[model samples]
Target: MPSSDKTPFSRRALLAGAAGLAATSVGVASWQQLRQPKARVLQARCDSYDANLVGILLEGMAAFPAMLAKARGGHVVLKPNLVEVHPDRPINTDPRFIAAAAAAFLEVGAARVTVAEGAGHTRDAEFLLERTGLDELLRPMGVPFVDLNLDEAVDVRPPANLTRLGKLPVARTVMSADLLVSMPKLKTHHWAGVTLSMKNLFGTVPGHVFGWPKNPLHWAGIPNSITDLWSAIRPSFAIVDGIVGMEGDGPIMGTAVPMGVLLMGEDLPALDAQATRLMKLRPEGVEYLRQALELGATVSKHRIELLGDVITPRPFDVIESFHRLRA
Candidate 1:
């Protein structure tokens, strides 16, 4: 049946308008030195809804001009958050962002680059790639697709306090990458509170080896588990997609907030702390960040230099359970 348009009061139009209105509300800036397309955290308030803007934003945040000169000869591995099979609205990392990022890596002269994610909370990586639009984006690029969940596993020693999980079988793809880029989405989690770059490394290990320890990690406490994971896998770079951050009931059935921001950094803690600050949530309050800080994971703000939007912080509608009550 050919549907007749009655009055154009559809949910798609409403949501699109809602998102566009939020994006267009911000003022545009000339490509100043501070807000140039080469900033470490390129946060342009893009008015246009075109997906091509993903490429522009990626070039900006990655500071491609500078990074490419240095990364010209190495293999690059992009690890995006395909933690679930939900739509891009609030579940996984945006496919446009990932494609744009992968393209940027190629532009910068990466000998070869590949996008990989070990689907855990979700069963199939290809399903996530399709749902997130990554399949179409990577089809023409000839990038290798690796299902981490189905990869050949190699046993490795667990870090201190994590031996209960025993020797874990890690995905060979993640283990062999010369340069690992952690591409994570900005969202609150029911259990982990916030799933940033550091926590996203969970997808690197095979479920067969690390799944059992999930309970021990949580039971022992969230921070320690995260610290253990960080120690296990060290990413060379990080890119946090905050273009549309998730707020309440996040990482799954959460509401999306139009943050319109992208962050990048060489140090995981430095970038994660900056992201935590932007969320207007106390970094010290986040158990994993706090524990990472305690473990000397580079939380010192003095060491980091800002390169993008001079954004004033805004309060995230943090869940009460996640919020810490100070004495």
Candidate 2:
């Protein structure tokens, strides 16, 4: 991971460069040009990692296939938050959710469901997979896992110039996917505030090309990198694992908090906004979330109707110092 302080680059310089790209990327045009998306309800299930949990989760996500018309009859990609493993803290997105999502997608008519992720922090993707227990969880489902880092690369340009980044080299598998399901763990992040579906898109950029943790983007600014990458990939849908979330010092080192809930939505910003509030933080306070709303019509600001076991997230054990770091 690149240090925020001594980042081999300067934020001032990056923003200056982004200013020039902004004119071409996310044009200074009318908001009507970027037609806002409709609000959709995604059902979430609160379940632990148990045998019966997958079945219950599948039932909760039953509406997804029909909800995302594009997903049906297309190749789907399940991107779980497999950052790094920890026996004590629930840092990564639970594999149970990934398994359940894969099963649900296949049930709804997805031609093929491939489980893929580029472990940004870890050099060896296989070790990360095995330690995270995703290997065991995906095997029975016969879901194949592909290391996005080693996969072929392709250049992509987002229609929305939401960030300073220009053409990005994303994993070929991710570029060609008909549907991208951002399966991310709900956790607090020092730089991005809270990393949900949008932040999770960082893994889609092959580390082999960009460097572990994708430092080039970090040099560009974590918030800027996220918005740029998200617009480029634009995941079709999302499932956030809040069942067990990390807080305090997170995304890796943080105490586990049992929020005991799962959140789903096609509008990731709404989902991320809801997740941010669930963490007791404001959505507008987070740079990327605000940018997400800016790109759309604050679709999440209107509130996404929550379905299935709707409950307020348990107060997470967030870092006290960051509590005042709200944007």
Candidate 3:
């Protein structure tokens, strides 16, 4: 069922309640198992989207046999960053990359592969898909696209409840997926420091319940809301599109940087941390990453194991205020 509460909840009330419950609600120790000394992250260098992306993705996916085994005969949902459509800017994940990912998963024996996104910026999903060329690429492949913004919702109490919203109304399609894949475009953000895998989960928050652009989450707090969402959704894997990334004042309105790489891993935090470093930024300077580390998410280089290409660090431009995040 969809959320019945149409009115937005008060941010003050939610924060106050969360402050009281956080001590007991957040279980840091339970996430300890994920804090490995070396979490495997595959970093494949693909010069452009036109390259053999499917072959590269399949090779990377093969590295994690356990995840593939689990994906076998299971429903797989690809949550790509479909923020908005812009002709000149690299605002959304490249549609070619999304199609390649879908093809790779189907080849690996996924019972079903669905492309899903609850775009925060726009309500017209069809127009976004059409404009971004995603509809054209996905249609011939028989891959169904779910507009998560309009999907049925279920109230879920986040294990961490860091935002004190008590329960989040998550899209039913994402909640029921056998395996959820977060496919985010690597980018710098005006808020949240950097938007990577974990931040990409923001699309799962049904716009029907949270309103367009998810204002309630922003009102509560972007960082806290991100961590809380991670605790609730716990996506199965991540594939970050970094072949062409955004820099400076982003999420939108940034210039593109052709970093020429694709990152894949089961550990979202570790993968994001590695991506942050590749951008020549410090993950610890990012609030959500710091909070994630506190909750036992791995961010340190010593904790991540890299495979594939050895690309040199490239500094991505950022707004004046975010200068401190530069490494």
**Per-prediction TM-score:** 0.77, 0.83, 0.89
Candidate with the greatest TM-score versus the true structure: 3
Write one digit per residue (lDDT tens) for candidate 2, span 122-202.
888888878878889889888899999888889888666554566788899988889888889989986777889999988
| RMSD values, in order shown | 17.4, 11.5, 12.9
Better of 1 and 3 by TM-score: 3
Q: Point out the higher-scoring one by lDDT: 1 or 2.
A: 2
Model 1: per-residue Cα lDDT over 21-100, one tens digit each: 76665433121122322213444453222456556655564553444554577778899887666554566777777777
Runs off by more than 4 Å, candidate 2: 1-37, 65-68, 159-163, 297-300, 325-327
**lDDT of each structure?**
0.69, 0.77, 0.91
Q: What is the lDDT of candidate 3?
A: 0.91
Candidate 3: worst-modelled 10 consecutive residues by lDDT: 24-33
**Rank by lDDT (best first):** 3, 2, 1
> Which residue pairs overlap in candidate 3's backbone?
none
